[model samples]
Every structure is written in C-alpha cells, then in structure tokens.
Target: MALGLALPAAAQNVDGVVRPAWAPSGLPDRVVLSPGADAARQMAVAWRTDARQADAVAEIVEAIDGPAFESRARTVDGLSTDGVVRGGHGRYHTVRFTDLKPGAGYLYRVKGADGWSEWLSFRTAADEAAPFRILYFGDTQNSILSKGARTIRAGLMRTSPDVVVHAGDLTGRSHDWEWGEWTAAGGYGYAMVPQIPAAGNHEYSDDDDGRRRLGPLWAAQFALPENGAEGVVETSYYTDYQGVRFIVLDGTAGTSLDALDAQTRWLDRTLASSTARWNIVIQHQPIYTCARPNDTEALKAAWEPIYRARNVDMVLQGHDHCYSRITDGDGKASGEARRAQGAAQGPVYVVSVAGPKMYGLNDRALTQPDRVAADTQMYQTIDVEAGRLRYRAYTVSGVLYDAVDVVRAADGTKTLREPVESLPPLRLCDGDVGPDGAPCVGSAK
Candidate 1:
C-alpha cells in the first residue's frame, strides 16, 4: 500500500551556534536576585546556561509605568563562565548590577550565542524598615525535582516572598545534575527573590584527586557579604537588612578549637553591636535536633550562651529531615517537666525540612518539642512585624500544618500563642514506614 508520509519540519540549524539536545530546554537556569547594600540602589543576579553558550551577557532595565514598568535598558557586568557536566554539558554564569536606586524594580535579560533569554524582572528591597516576607526551606538535597520542587513552588505561589533562606543541603552532591535539579526546583522564584544559603555538610567533599573542597558552587552562585571571620570567608558571614541581622556560621571548619572560638567571639560581638531589632542566626546543624542525637553540644557550649545573653530572637537549622519548634528554652515539654527543670529564656531553635526525604521522629521529640512533625515534606514562612513574629509551617500541598506567633511585649517578654487553626494529621511514625506506606526512618544516631 502506498502511504503519503509527512515529516515535521527539520530543526533549524544556524552556523556557529551550538545547542545541545538535552540542554536547558527553556531559558537560563538557577537565576538568583540578591539585594545590595542600598536595597533600592544595587542588586546581584546569577544563572546557568548550556555549555554551547559559555560567554553569555545579561541586560537589565528599570521598569517604569505599566504593570510591566518598562524602563531604560542597560548592560550589567558579567561573570566568568564555567563548564558544568550534569546529565550532559552545561555552563553557569553570574552577574552583578550596582549603583541602582533603593526599592526599585529592574528587568533583565541574558544574551547567549543562540538567542536571548526572556525578560526576567526583580525588585530591590526597600532601604527603610518596611514590612516584607521571607520563605525558609531546609534539606532540599535529595529527590529535588520529584518531591522538593513542588513544595518550594507551592510556597512561592502561596507567598510572594521578598527573600528565601536555605537552611542547608541545597543539593545532594556537588554535581551538575543535582545543581540543575536545585535550580529547577527553585525555577523562576529564585530570580525573583534573593537567596540566603547556609553551608551544610553535604556541601563539603574530601580530597581525592586534589580537587575536593568546601563550597565550590556556593561562592560562584551567590554574591554574599564578605565580612565574615578572618580565615572563614564564604562559609561564615553576616548580612543586615532593614531592622534584622542574619548571622551565618560554618561548622565544617575544624582548624582547632580556635576556629569555633573565633566564630563565637565574632558572633558575640556582632550580636552585641547590632542595632537591629531582630537577630536571626542560620546554620546547617541544629543545636537541638528532633530526629538525631543531641550532638550540638560544642555549638551549644560555645554559642548558645551568647544567644541567650544577647536575646537572639530565633535560630534556624536543617539537616534532620523533620520539623520541630523548641521554645521556652527548656528543650522540654511545657508542662510539669519544664517546671521541674526550672528553665528560663533562650533562643527558639527550629529544625525543619522542605524536601521529600523523610525521617522518623526521635523518642525525645514526642514531648520535648512544643511542636513536631516526622516523615513529611514541609516548608516555613516567617513574617516579622514590629515587636511580633508569626511563623507558620505547611505541608507540600499548601496545608497549614502548624503555626505559632511570638509577641514581644514592650517589657521584652516574648509570649507565644497557638491560634485555633485546623491542621493536618500529626503524622508521626514509630518504625521505618508510616501507615501510608512511606519510609519514615528516624535520623541516624
């Protein structure tokens, strides 16, 4: 039988332009927007592209009138390009735009060898103490695309946060595919919101081919504050925004007790000197874990006292793929047990996860934490108002699972409130799997 076969138009091939079949099918990936010192004045951006277009440049413009606010066009400084071999070959670049006015929206584009990327837009943070929102996620290291991506996307859709905080483990490994997954999970939200990432254990590797190092992709991906400790540059640093101060610490450095000692001293000085009303500290390891053993004694012995002495508001951590809100400083339940122990004010330690990896809750988690969750994917949104902070945790499906509000009275006493909100089932597991056939193994001791 004679059949008339029609073939689709052959893919267009242009001379001198290299495009890989499996490269980022869409626009540039891992787009990040960072606020500069002036908020309204300066900002930074980073993104990844396919290897074919290694030397790519970015175009930025200020949006003015309409909802799009199309403004004048200008070119910003481009960063050095590097090769990333993931599922295939890829390239990554970063760019920084300075001298911008505070609290202004800027639209940008990336020009590659093949074509130019779409116009991505971002706004600088207001230079003054204006209300803003931030999204916090933890341990998006494994199952990034399948399970973690949806949670992150949901969080972004639910709350158009001004900035995002990664507690740690942005990728399972420092490989190209993992990085691609990380950026994909974030998607366009990364470009819209500035990212503040902490260094986790997964970000480190041992020396094998003399190429092993700590935080290789981190420095290249984000333009952070450089005012960290003397030797610990990228791993440990602090940034100030509006009325808050965020201090990040690195626990991987083991030069000696001297290293942690130096960090402790720096932390004390930073907290003591900061005039900001809110002081939040971020790190990978939790001082009080709900899934793992109590192994943060070194940090506790060194930094906890400082946090308490300085009235630090909150301490956020991730590494144990679970959720916990430890308040009252007792690290114990808020009943007779705490009264018997006679505890006082201390920093509220919260350990949470946003990815699919699940861990069974520890035995102590049952009564020790004021609120706890196990074997679940979750994210946190924290809203800071004048003398009041509201924190709410949600499941991947946008269900409000847990919530707490801390109101600081004029006398400096913080009060906690649990509003009457219907939450999902507690969903705790005793063994490796829950009734829903999901693995819930607790953290390794």
Candidate 2:
C-alpha cells in the first residue's frame, strides 16, 4: 500500500505532510504595556483580537538568559463589543495582565483560537529614583499611517522611553481602520513601552441609544490603571514612576464646573499628597494653546490655578497641531507685559503634534512663546534625572527644532534652559493656510 493511502485526509507523509498554512487565529494588534502602582514590581499588558477569540489569554515569563526564559502564564477573558461599519459588524476583545513584578524583564504572549502570538519582551520601570525617559506624542489622529506613523517611528528610534504619553486624539475617528492605522503607527514600540493615553474628543461616539459611549476601541484596547478619580473609572488617573507623578486629566469630563470641581478636588489632593520629586500634568486640551486663538478657558480656569499652586513642573497637552513651550521668563518674546504676567517658576506648558494635521500658529505664538513651531510635525523626548529634566523637541526630519531643560533646586525653584538654535521667523499669513499649505486655523466656534 502506498504511504499516501495510509495518511488521513488532513495528514501527509513525514517530509511531505500536507499541513495547513499557519493562519494566526487572532491578530495580536494594539499590544501595550501599562504600569501598576509599583513601577519596579508590577505591569499591565493589553491587546485586542478578533471576535472569534472571545477568551483572550496572556502568558508572561521571566527572562533568565536569551530568548529562552522561565515564565508564568495568566489568562483573562475580555468583554466584546459589536461595532457596525458600513453594513457589517465586527467584534473586538481586550485582555489585561496585572500583578507583574516591578523592574523585572518579562516575556509575554497572547493566545487566541487559532494560535499564540510571538513572544514579546518588556522590562518594567526601575524602582523609584531610577532615572528614565518618556516619549511624548500629540494628536496622532489624522493620516496616522501616511504622515503620523513615520513621526512616531522616528521618535521611538531616537529614544527607548520607559513610557509613552499620548495627548489624546489617538485616532481621527472611532472607525476600526482608523484604530488599525493608529496601532500600526506605533508598530512594535507600543508593545515594548508602556503607554499612558488620555482620552480625546474623538474617543467618544454616539451609541445606538443616542447616549454618548466611549469608542469601542478605546478602553477595549488599553488596560489602564484603575486609580482614576471618583465617578470616573479610567478617564482621569495619576501614576507615579521613579519619583515623578504624572497626573492625567480628562478635559471632557472636567469641562463642566461640577465635574471640574470634583476633578479639581481630586487633583488638589493628588498633588498635595504626591511625594514624587517631579510633578507633570498631561491632558488633551491645552491651557495655553499656540495654534488656537484663545486658550482653553474651562481647562485653564479649573487646572491652571492648581498647576500654579502645586508648582507643577510641566504641562503636556495636544489638540492644537502647533508647537509651543510657554515658560515664566520672557526670553526671546518676553517684554514688560510678559514679565509682569509670567509666573515666576510656574508650570511650563508645552503643546505639540506628531500627526499630519497642520494648523497655523496663533498670532500670539510668535510674540508669546519661549519657543514655537508651526506647520511642522514633531514629537518630544524628555529625560528626567535626579535634579534635572531635559526636553528636546524634534521635527519629523530629525532636526532639533526646539530644546529646553529645567533644573530643580532643593528649594523647589527651576532654572530654564533657553532655545539655542532658532529657526526663521514664522511668516504670518492672512488665511487659514499655514506656511506648508495646510489649513492652520480651525473653526473658532
């Protein structure tokens, strides 16, 4: 009898076995690492898979040597949401891993119906007081793959940051393809570095019941810390890493006075009790915007006072596609007006964009900002050391567009490092079109 005759329909010879092509059961996309209470001890892993794999599981193992390492596995089943697009509905599943050891390097993999994903490795942040870096990107909401993706990849190549802070607008729309592009933009970097994302306007959509519902992809894809403010689960939260306290606020929720009051109280308490040497606030809307004609009044009214009172070191924001670094001193733009108005060591507000959307700098940008850039896609890398924090803003072309450093003294005063290489004056135009021919100004209403 022929060997083929003895083989089963799904089986073949040893060397010539007709095996099925490896069709990965679920695509392990949008993988992210999140920090727990203890940076050196715990981490959170999150990922999304197709609807077919409702029960998504993650396995983590400690890396003893090279690729092969000892490991432990944990399985988490996620909730599913039906997202209808065009005429069809798709399902998305999210799973998270918690209780990881701090500062330890671990390898993780996700399993779906078809199979398991390739092992990805990530190291938790070092114990408190360990110097580290973080990548900051603003508004990767439009043209994520075409224009924004390159900028994000460039930033990752420049520095291996411990975490990534996105200033909202992670996607232009809640559409799946947009989410796909958003995930692709980060590529493998997101899987490697834990991401701390704040909610943006685009992350909310009207549900079938006419009530506002979080975009199905937002929370489903990220396993954020549950330490957000009261009444809000994952929207507003604070995380401490290496003596730095990152207060992430939800501007949408804080837009109303009532909501703002609640968050304000929480923020005050969080800041007042924070023991971190460095305190930075991250939000979606800018309290002081460089692209918008006026600042976000609601946010400014509720948060700026706290920032000033708390001696917050920095304010990182997006929503405006321009670049700005608003400090206390009137360096290049400082005049008598600014000197009298500027805070003596108040919070340094920075608004930048890493996406393709371009907006012209506001009229005040040229005259107000210690540093400003218009019609340029950029990302920021900040390095925090024992007594100093250095920030470098680079354009997509890898040009050092702006640079600043803040040195904190034992007395709590911060010394500012001014921009050294200044670019040409930003040509003010009458229309909305920026110097790069993209619409700079958006609807004021």
Candidate 3:
C-alpha cells in the first residue's frame, strides 16, 4: 500500500538534502563581480567550475540592443586555482577586465567544461564624481539561505544599488557549504552587482597546527584589489567608486601584534591621499558596541583618532547582532542639540546585523544609538551625491525603519539631519518575549 516501497533505505537518505543548487559543476557557477582599485575603467569577476575546466576563459562585449553583439566579443584568459570543496575537487577562476569604457554597460560570460554560462551584464563606474546608490548589509553569517536571502533581496530589489557592501561575517564558519549558500541566496544578482566585502572574525579558522588563518575560499572566490596594508593583502583592500573611497580593514588581523601598526600607518597614508568626495571605512568590529557590554576599545584606541583626524564620513561595521547608529561619540548631548549647536561632527559610526542570529541590547544601547533595532534583520541604502549623503534603513519586508541625511558644507563640515517623518517604533524584546509577541530567539550578552 506504500508508495516506492521497493526503494532502498540508503538510497532514500542521500546527501542531496544539504547540497546547494549553485554547487560547482561542469558549468560555471558562483559568478561574482568585484571592482578594481579604479572601477571606472576596470572590474573583475570570479567563478567556480569542475576540475575538467582547468583553464579560466571569459568573453566580454559591450551590451547592445540586439543579440548579435557577441560578434564583437573578445576572449580573455585568466588565472585559475584548484581546491577541494565539499569533499570534491573543483577549480576557481578569476578574470579582470581592464581598459573598459567608463559609465558603459558590458556583458560577460565564462566557460565551463561543456559550454559557456549565460551572459551577465555590469556597468563600469563613471570617470567623474557622480551620484550613486549603495546597498549595505551588516552580516549574513547564520541562516544565510533561509533568512538572509529575504533581506538581501529586499535591498537589491528596492534600491537597485550601483554597488553592495558587506560589513563582514558573511558565513558562520566559512565552510564551503556556507559560501555556496551565500552565492546561491544572491543568485544572479551577485553576477551583476559589484560587491565590496570586509573580513570578519568568522572568516578565520584554526588550522591543524592550532594557528588561525584566513579562510581558503576567500582568495579563490573574490578577486579584490591588493592595495592594502602589508601582510593583509587578501583580507584588506580599498576601492574608489563614483565619488566614494571605500577603505576595507580587517578587524581580525588588527588583533595581531604588528598588523594593527602596519594597518594604522596604511590607513593614515591612504586617507591622506584619498581624492574622493566622500571617505567610508568598512570593517567588522564596531568602535561603539550596541549589544556587547564593552566597546571594541582596541579598535577605538587605534583607529578612532585616525578617523577623526582624516575626517572620515562614516564608519560602517558589524558583529554586534543588532542595529545602531551613533552620531555623537560622547553621548552627552541629544542629536538635535548637537546638530543645532553646529558642533563639528566627527565620523558617524553605525553597527548593524542582517542575519538570523540576534543578541540583546546592552547598556550602551540606551545612550549611543540614535536609531536602534533588536530581533530584526535589516539592510541599509546610502545615496551619495556631491554635497549630501542620504542614508535609509529598511526591514526585510521593505518597510522604512530609519533615515538620516549628512549634509556637507562648502568648508567640509557635516551636519546630521534626523528623519523628516515618523519612523516605526523601536523593535526590542520585552524580557523573554520578542517584538512579535513570540518567544525571544536572541541571547543576552
């Protein structure tokens, strides 16, 4: 009376349950676009293929109205590396496209063992200072496929950003499957939009020798610019896009003895040399903690003064598992008072979380956060113009949660403007009950 009763028990319990749809195969998969140091004329893409496809082959052509554009396509060769993934051997390939026309759209595809992948399109940054939208996510560490996908899709679909920035902790443990999940969750969007990623603590793991090292897949998956501090080339880098100079720092490496000193010097040099209209620092650990009892004092001591001295516009960070935007470092005056007094604004610090994992807000959350959220997954969008930067945060359902405008004067002073309209009430857990009246899923720090 039972259906498929003849099937063997072992056959019924195959490992297909955990295998990702975007797993490495004869066909190219996990294609992601990343920017070079100068995005106006160069961009790079990375993908995975089966071992049979050892060589990295790609073709690019300026996008056109007709499908015959492939006639003008030119083949480009790239570097390839082989590694074991999910108990199987595969090859990762990275191809950097140079001398591309500024502000032009181009289509590209990679080759696999059997055939070529579908043509994915991307646009190069403008040669001059221009307005652009940036989608920023704090962390997509846990439940990347199940929970992180919705938030990522919301930001991508709603904002249609020119670029995406990850604060860090992209995966829970940097497992091969976790990386696969991250790529699968974003789907084709990862191929189209250029991503700026920072390295989180989770991106490092203990080797058999009991020494922690950066994850293996990091180098193989994303081809980032090597213009960073010495010894952290793969984990730290900087890129200038449109009118913003994004300086990505590795917080995990900062814990080391000499790495922080080297990075601090590099930070000063890079910031001093930046010609972009806006400067933003991206990293993992927050200078001001929202969920944790104590702030990241080491980062604050080493980088805070540099940020102030360099006049950084914003410091985007993650790892708190909550949301916070700190405009006033001292927390002595209200946002209105500080803005009305025309006090010189330092770099605005923001900490956020985009994953399912949650943590309770700590004592500092009471005084620091101008906007705060708990037990909620969110994404932020920043609209960058010559004189003003508009930032807005949205929930997974696309509801506006927070808004702020940083207006810059001709003299280079910044003023923080609060929300024009009423924002949704702060989302926080009541004792052990969540904002949704359900059992709280977050843990107390």
Worst 10 residues of 3 by lDDT: 1-10
Off by over 4 Å in 2: 1-25, 70-96, 206-212, 256-258, 329-344, 419-445
Return the candidate ranking by TM-score, descending.
3, 1, 2
Candidate number of the best TM-score:
3
lDDT of 3 by residue, 279-337 (tens): 99999999998898888888889999999999999999999999999988777357557
Reference-based lDDT, each prediction: 0.71, 0.71, 0.85
- TM-score of each model, in listed order: 0.85, 0.84, 0.94
Q: Report how far off residue 78 is in candidate 3 (Å).
A: 1.0
| Alpha-carbon deviation at 248 in model 3, angstroms | 0.3
Better of 1 and 3 by lDDT: 3
Residue-wise C-alpha lDDT for candidate 1, range 65-180, written one tens digit per residue: 56553346877657655654222245666777887766787788776666777787777766666667778898998877767777788787787787788898887766555665
RMSD of each: 7.3, 9.2, 5.6
Which has the higher TM-score value, candidate number 1 or candidate number 2? 1
The candidate that achieves the highest lDDT relative to the unseen native structure? 3
